[model samples]
Target chain A: MKNAKLRLETCLSPAMYSKHANDDNIVVVVDILRATSTICTALHNGVKRIIPVSTVEEAKAKKDEGYIVASERDGYVLDFADFGNSPFNFTADKVKDKEIVYSTTNGTRCIHMAAHSKAVVVGSFLNLTALANWLIGQDSPVLIFCASWKDRFSLEDTVFAGALAEKLLASGKFETICDAVTASLDLWSLASPDLNGYIQKAAQKGRLAAKGLDDCIEFCHQPDFTSVIPVFADGDLVPVS
Target chain B: MKNAKLRLETCLSPAMYSKHANDDNIVVVVDILRATSTICTALHNGVKRIIPVSTVEEAKAKKDEGYIVASERDGYVLDFADFGNSPFNFTADKVKDKEIVYSTTNGTRCIHMAAHSKAVVVGSFLNLTALANWLIGQDSPVLIFCASWKDRFSLEDTVFAGALAEKLLASGKFETICDAVTASLDLWSLASPDLNGYIQKAAQKGRLAAKGLDDCIEFCHQPDFTSVIPVFADGDLVPVS
Candidate 1:
């Protein structure tokens, strides 16, 4: 490592996007609570493709094209949404061989922000090792942009970013790192093995669990449960086959 | 601890000021490399006051009022400046009972940005214990805004913030914390008992060392070297008597 050839940086929240989050870097957007976890789980179970639209209107627009609309607002299913963004709803029996047009309050917006990156990939604890393996094979710099709860720093999303940052740092593939990335790595190290307990007690857990999706918290914590990598390109998330 | 009554947040770089950096929070501006360290050192040696002006013109303007002008640009003393920002120059013999008006490339600018806060205080490794004690006595939310190198995050300022954050988190005064503060705490824990060695390998060390200020780095690394707290009020940095 030339200590400068490859660098790792993290945006603790997409709302904190500075010019440093340029299009030149490979962006791994992490929304561990549900969105990315759900997408990865759906893809691992043989979902055809996912349209990560920015708005519920856009997702519903894709509904006429035989895409199952999945949307959530404030952690609940929207009025007309077929399914809320929860991994519990993304089972192999239901979503296999189907298309999903998904939109959420925060995750979808973050995914749209990644449209200008060199490449956009979804990551969560559910596919931690799988995404880390894929990211390690890339030549470009990496940016982990956390889709925090409505731009406020959520504990779960940051811990997820920290987990990925730890993997990237340990690979010794990068020479330079920003403070946020370093902090994430330290946080991950501080809360290992008990990651589920950490998420269960996260400040955001009250708001999420209050929404009656406590199971989503548990479901998202299963690390490396799937080998599928859901990549965003051409405005849709497709398995990197 | 109400856990929500007092919150701690950190801006890794002054340039990364987000809307979450509320003006209502008590801002503790940290520049541990040499600026805050020098201020603590000078005040400890019985300096009357420090005027941390943002512009060279403002500092020069204060010169007419019999205040000693100290300024630095690009890690070296400006040609006409009375002194550069270095702890080596702030000794009891040279600065005792004197009024110093100082400006630096990055630290002073960060101090000026603290004007909107409920109160602004300077923090460094030198006054770490004293500053933490004072802040723990406060009831308001705290923000540790690190004055990094220019607009980017520097390794030194953040480490100082991390040190303070760890203290604050342990004090049981805070009810909530953002990821930045948590990360800083972890960083501080990871570098304990060897802060000097950590500073020696910092990314910013190369630039300062190249300027022949290696002695200054060593001086700033000495934790608890001072008991004075420099508070920014009415546009000047005055010792909190």
Candidate 2:
């Protein structure tokens, strides 16, 4: 039987997914801005574990238990937190063998919204190829849930979703049901073979540049910075072992 | 001072204006899937007037006053209505001096959402060049709100938005603020001078083909079918005149 997988790329917000809660499929939550990038970097640097809580209070509670607290809000690190959203904050020596409690503005909320999904995988550009391969192997429909900024669609996240969808279609692993998904694939195809340049010159990156955050944009655009697949299991973002 | 006018090709939703709702701007709503297309056809063909109500009941209530209820739900024409959503249904001879009470799944809702905008124009491929020229002459930010399928993103609508945005950029009339909109412009640039073929082979059109609705897609893709600009004002759709 052909796998009847449904892929949804959504920005992380309660408003985006609340309507589709009854959907029975795997939801891949993506927050490419800095959350997923930060998580991928931390894990690749040998962070033993990450407990992704939904609130700053929960992060603090976990910190009281002696875990390193990594939290961000409004694109900046909380004053008392040990880490901010920048991928550069997580280095190999700093995170090796250390468990951390983490939270973020949009990505964590997305994981919570997809808590009822059959499987929820944390996705970002860093592991795009691996996630695409894993989605093809799945027996269920795939939902590329983009954690869009707040509840609105983010260009980078949607493009990332489109890029993944394009890969899946090129691999001939699944069929697309939505025009948005297919159009996204078309957009990706047009930008393919030079996706990094595409990202650097994109509107979101430009905005960050105007705000003097080009470093963060460059860090997020780095491809295959890690091979770790972060899966939201039992309310925690653990590396796919 | 540089004219910081934003163009439609780069962004295609109300979300793009979320950060600048109070900014002086003109928004054009596009829904090629029958609403804007139908409206353009109706006005061009001699429909004396068109009242775009928000709900089926509102359309019926207007119909009770002897207006022709041309309503669509779920992309299908409701029974007991004088017309469905087909632009062909609104030819000059048929709609001459007629008052149409129209309601649709998406387009009208977008009109309502943009009711407070400085100016709201209905756009489609049917009037692509004319709309682009008009946008260039305006000083306010131009927002192309794609009346996506039932509030979800739709490729056909966004692509049309992208095309309009591309035209504005080429005319040197607007600056893009949002990343998604800029990406859309880039996507449009890559696929330009061949949009007709692009839309025909797009995923949405593919789905329509699967359902044997290729005729509708072909009809919707017809360019410059009408030169009239349909503007939403005073709770009705009328020619810009």
Candidate 3:
């Protein structure tokens, strides 16, 4: 049901999340460069549940416990991990019904930061429309939390935020008085015409491109690639039932 | 001489200032709704120097000491203040040749936050062009610091940062890879065409409007209204000699 009273706001970085956090608001954690995208893809491809930890050491500990782990830091696959943060790494053959532990430089930290919200759901361009629809169905206000690059703004996450905010606003169910939301909506309007080209200017895109691991950049921005909504429940991300 | 190597960045809020702060950079403190704008107008109107205090209690103490004090909190003049933060209150007859103590809800604190930078200067649409020109002549990288509303994003400050950054970048002496800069520049591009209309959406505007104190909103965005760059030196804002 549409609720005109529900506010939509965007937190530009995870570091700023505390100011925007509300126990009743649904927080949408976004790390469109790869982490959230990978989570969405992993769940869609039949992964049972994923444990997201903040530190690489925690991920290693989870791995030693016999859990399949996917770890990355600064865009590189950890030597002890089974996979990096690429959505491709979570294909059905490798991840089907497996419980994977995931960690990244920025994304996973945000999911944990927003753990206190009414519901913390993972968002990526791949699940943009689906997440928006899910949010519209809920009664809570929506806070789009960008897992920015190490507490600094990341163009890709913000652009994806703008994309999702645009969808939410279009539903006529949400409104915003936040400058961050207004700015993101404008950024989305500007970047949506040529997303691949637009993302080329992102600092993260350059970071991943320099590492030769940006093959997933295009895939990450592919809207509606999956309809799965990864919700954090009891320390694991499982698709909504 | 122009240095292509010099990078320009925008810190969207004073809360996020430390992440972008550098001992070698020039930090331009901006609070476009009124505080910084009032500072520029105060200095330009021949106020000897303005001492900025962070708290209302500090401002009251300064007032008790016989210093002319301008104090505001949440868009209203404090009961003990001789003046509010409106730029119009600093006319030559009233503030000329007198040292005034100032405190505001957001901007003064930001001025203090960037005090450790190589240089901390005030920027507003009022001094946009002159501030950009002066920054181009400096050898250090630039950080545009926005005194956002209580550590949240403010559309007015980011838009002004964009306006200042646009001029700096146009000089060809500055370049930026930071997403905040790119986002600001894009916002400036969009907001430049209709600034008053653009700023109408700011949450701060609504706050000021509700109090009937929004008359200065148009005056605040009038570009290059004065060229008096208020640089912080030895605890006071004085014009560049």
Candidate 4:
């Protein structure tokens, strides 16, 4: 008998992850409004590794150990962090060849949530194509896990999950019975024509814009902006180019 | 200053309810594939009250106490249940003037999740207008909580939330910063033209179809099929009409 098609599912929040978790699936953790995007950009710009911690204090302790830290909460940089949750903050000058401890209001925590999966990978539009290609080659079921805002569903991460699910479904290698995946694909179709205009209404968009940190909003939604895929390995996210 | 617009939000799953929970919000628990639809139908047909229990044992205990039970798990009628999770099974002949002890895989569990809210109401496309009109007069924030399938996002419930939110927002009496609400509105727009066709792709559609229990699929999507709004009071869901 022919092998069953690989299943592709989109989990809209970390709070819902327990239902979708599987030891055999490759978990793609996405935080489109910037944590995963920052990880992709940092790896693409030659950062050695990213150590994702769930708590701000953990990132702070890593800072005390002289490791650079990138932290933010509620759309603002923490007072003691070297940088906030922005892709531009991870450019080569600061993060290159250095191990950075990262924490955010949502995303890094999701990485920890998926820490027990067989494989955990960071995803954003910046690494969309590369990540999709890598996932297709893995020959396992895929679960696109969105690092939703504060364990509540967030639009941008889910939209990105739709974009990635669309690609995966088009490859003829995946099948899904997940309503979240189907709804997300529908959302992707609606949002793809004008991502910027569509995302302007997102709650986080307004929050980030108010803090003048939304400059990366469009950049974060730009598919294939980078070729690096950040794979979780040995307690750090390292580039898989 | 004018009073703030009444907040409208969608809680996509019972698992995510804690983050969106507030004593100030009126919670509308939805289980669109069947549970809430059944509740609306039962009440419209003159069922005295519904006692929703979260577990099969509780429902069985209620049955032992001589109350009629309506129960299902997955997509079939439980061996001990007099009726399954289908609205058509709830006719005046069988259910009128009777009190039902109801339990289902997802919906009943969700009702308990919102039991502590300011008010817990039942909603489905069957009672869409009556519920919305009643909510307009309540002068309170509304949380449309979807009884998502097994703690994961389910498409039909979210689309129904969008339909209700559209009505609530149209009254010009409500506002929302919730991304889940925004996304649901988008889904409603996409699905409204062909709700049956759109929902045909839902996983539960296949589940119910396999059991020969999806005859009410179209009826479940029919807006305003009943005017009874089931409101939780004391320990039972009594008709508010």
Candidate 5:
């Protein structure tokens, strides 16, 4: 391991960073189901830009200026929005030159929480390898901020964090800072090589399935399906410059 | 293995039960750095009873009644207090038959947080098996409240929580409820069997040793050295009732 001294906090809630409050490291905010996944998909599919706002009002305000408004609440697309959290919505044709002002329940809120970090990158399974490679390229400490479900620990986020950690570990950097990170890696180790199969069977995925959002689950589990690394700069998540 | 349906959130913090609190299972509060270790040593050696109070004022009130006052601040014994957080201070000669009013930085606060729990048990490496067996006897869910460092995740507390999860898993009814518990159990698997060796070289233990607290480190790592399971009931921690 590279011993990069990373801090992997398990949630995107304000409560997680309210105590640590470090602005020196790279903060990769992950909301795997499905804001981050959607963002990576949009950017990867040639979306002009993504304006990640903290609230629906801000997104709506941007909408009046001709930006496509994408908002989701509780994992469902709001009736008035042009798009929801599905990756399929971000195909090349739909968002080729569009600017998306987006807001979601947990992921966007995490971007706000980590806005002050030295570098903020959006991460999901779709951009896992790219995010890890970028993190390893930097000497600064990395923090994997999991946008947990409603401020509590969620399996999917931690699993993504573990996958990230596993990749970083493969590069021989990034010491395990906390037991949670080590535990996450352990879970990831138990997972089959087919990452999508494992996530589709996860507790969070099961809950989504029960709610009849199996398509969203499949979309969220697609690994390396996108190559975009959404970096937050000046309060907006744009393509890494 | 027990399939007891153990929930990790219930174990990490008592705040989870704020809305629908259930005082059914045993709540194990762990502050492995010193508080719980000190209490375990105190009760094991011969302290008649230790009353864990939430605030210094409450501790002082108990002290006014002629009880021995033990208080800690910033991981050290407070000035004008009878003792700090060292387990060595809890020898049979010092605390035997004495009423102790105990207050520490984090452990007591956790005890108070878990006041609504059906039963609160103080757990540490010193009495891991005793605590686990008592929890197995109970019909309710076991909430292992890791009294983290100032309410943030601390490595020591998580390791202790992991140890508890490992023990529970061995009994064959404890079903992992949340990611946190599963993570803790995974950590336990990596660190146990030679827990003392693990702790002796842990980052926190190394820091403590630098401060000339190696004795406390050794004391805290003594697994199953004391068979006493201290149960918190009626505001006092006594042998499990």
Candidate 6:
């Protein structure tokens, strides 16, 4: 692989996270419905720094320190937390200049799992191009690690990964895509034309819509909606300038 | 789920297998390139039973009991085995009227892991309609478990699963489809017209071509190439007559 060209590959779920040789590659964890997407939107909305924690206990600890703890389980806001893991609450009126301790059912766990990678980035349709452009300038392979719906393959995350992959592929910087990457790229192409119709019927659709989080879905579904490239560095999520 | 309609979901790899609640569902294990495809071809050629084992040692134990042992690793046929796990070798002249024991790098392990399920069936593009028709006849939910290339997602298996899912959905037997299923179904629709063109660039392509197993690729790519339905029953693979 030393002599090979730069590549774009996707790990569909955290379960397949171990299958990737991501030690040398940049990983973009995509949890489009909606943790990663929410983080991206929040960063774009000027939240100071987002700390993605693994457990509710970890989130609560930071809450005691004055950080607003946002925790979600099964697509609803935790009774003890300040907010849900939805981007609707990430508007400037709410989270501007604030530090958020975020914990979600699936997405935060994915962020922690990829903490040791060369670099971990949060991806969504919100910041799709920004994420892709940053990766194109890198010299190593790029692994789009989709933080699927609870270790199960989720369409929204895969679609976001596919969007980033498509952007990178169009730039002609990463051409050596694996089969899974190809499949996702194809899926993104198919879904791009009518994304709302496609994602509204997604696997993770009911969990949020049932909780009246359709606003979160519409917020995250906007293509190239935000330019905030939220990168996980030194255990915190910060915008990459 | 009794009052609700039967759903069809797909697990793209064994990595995603644990994500499935398949205890009540019938899992159709698919490994188009080529374990499931090969097993379907073999059963079509009148192979009485296919004992899918997880290890070379287990395959050899079956060999000692007069089973025609087939083993493959890294796309190569083991010296002690009668043949490699390729559909091209499952011609009528070789496997007809035989009871075979098979073990491959990824697919067999998936079969063994899913043994405790209510019932497991082998699926491939070759028996796409047959597999879908059988599922439509049943009332239970169906899980298309793709035996991905070593716990990682593979395009061929996913495409096969999508094709079957497409068929099932069209029959109106399965209305509740998950995110992965929708992705695969869309992928299948996109790749259906030029499947060979799509699969030839699959992740497993170079590995098999490097090992001179390109014949396996051509054989497995044929859509609805055969009508045999190989179902895992009584701990063995047998054709559904």
lDDT of each: 0.78, 0.72, 0.89, 0.89, 0.73, 0.81
In model 2, how large is the Cα lDDT of residue A73? Answer: 67
- Model 1 regions lying over 4 Å from their true place: A1-5, A56-67, A150-155, A169-172, A198-201, B1-5, B56-67, B150-159, B169-172, B198-201, B210-214
- DockQ, candidate 1, comes to 0.30
For model 6, report DockQ. Answer: 0.79
Interface Cα root-mean-square deviation for all models:
3.7, 3.5, 1.0, 0.5, 3.8, 1.3
**Residues B1-241, model 4: lDDT tens digits:** 8878999999999889999999999999999888899899999999999998878889888888998998887776778889887888889999889999888768777777788889999999999999999999999999999997889888999999999999999999999999999999999999999999999998989988898988999999999988889998988999974
- Please report, as a residue range, the 10-residue window in candidate 3 chain A with the lowest summed lDDT: A1-10
The predicted structure with the larger DockQ, 2 or 4, is 4
Docking quality category of candidate 1 according to DockQ thresholds = acceptable
Q: Pick the candidate with the highest TM-score.
A: 3
Per-residue lDDT of A32-138 in model 6, one digit per residue for the tens? Answer: 87788889888889899998887778877887788888887766677778988778777898899988888876777777787778888888888877777788887
Candidate 4 chain A minimal-lDDT segment of 10 residues? A104-113
Which order, best to worst by TM-score? 3, 4, 6, 2, 1, 5
lDDT of 3 by residue, A1-241 (tens): 7435788999998667778989998999898888899999999999999998889899899989999988887777899999888888999999998989988767777877788889999999998898989999997899999888768888888888899888888888888889899999888888999999988988888888899988999999999999999999998899987
> Which residue ranges in model 2 land beyond 4 Å of their true spot?
A1-15, A19-23, A54-61, A210-212, B1-23, B201-213
Model 2 chain A weakest lDDT span, ten residues long: A5-14
- In order of the candidates, what TM-score does chain B achieve? 0.93, 0.88, 0.96, 0.96, 0.87, 0.94
Clashing pairs in 1: B3-B175
lDDT of 5 by residue, B19-104 (tens): 22457756788888888988888999988788887777777777777888888665667665788668888879889988888887
Per-residue lDDT tens digits of candidate 3, residues B1-241? Answer: 7435788999997667778988898999999888899999999999999998889899999999999999888777899999888999999999999999989767777877888889999999999888889999987899999898878888999999889888888888788889999889888888999999999989989988999999999999999899899999999999987
Compute DockQ for each candidate against the true complex. Answer: 0.30, 0.44, 0.74, 0.93, 0.27, 0.79
True contacts kept of each: 0.27, 0.43, 0.57, 0.98, 0.16, 0.92
Per-model root-mean-square deviation over C-alphas: 3.4, 2.9, 1.6, 1.5, 4.1, 2.4
Give the candidate order by descending DockQ. Answer: 4, 6, 3, 2, 1, 5
Per-residue lDDT for A1-241 in model 4, tens only? Answer: 9878998988998889899998888999988888888889999888898888878789888989998898887777888899887888888888778888888767767777777888999999998988898898989999999998889999999899999999999899999999999999999999999998999999989888899998999899898988899998988899864
Error of 5 at A151 (Å): 1.5
| Candidate 3 lDDT score at position A132 | 89
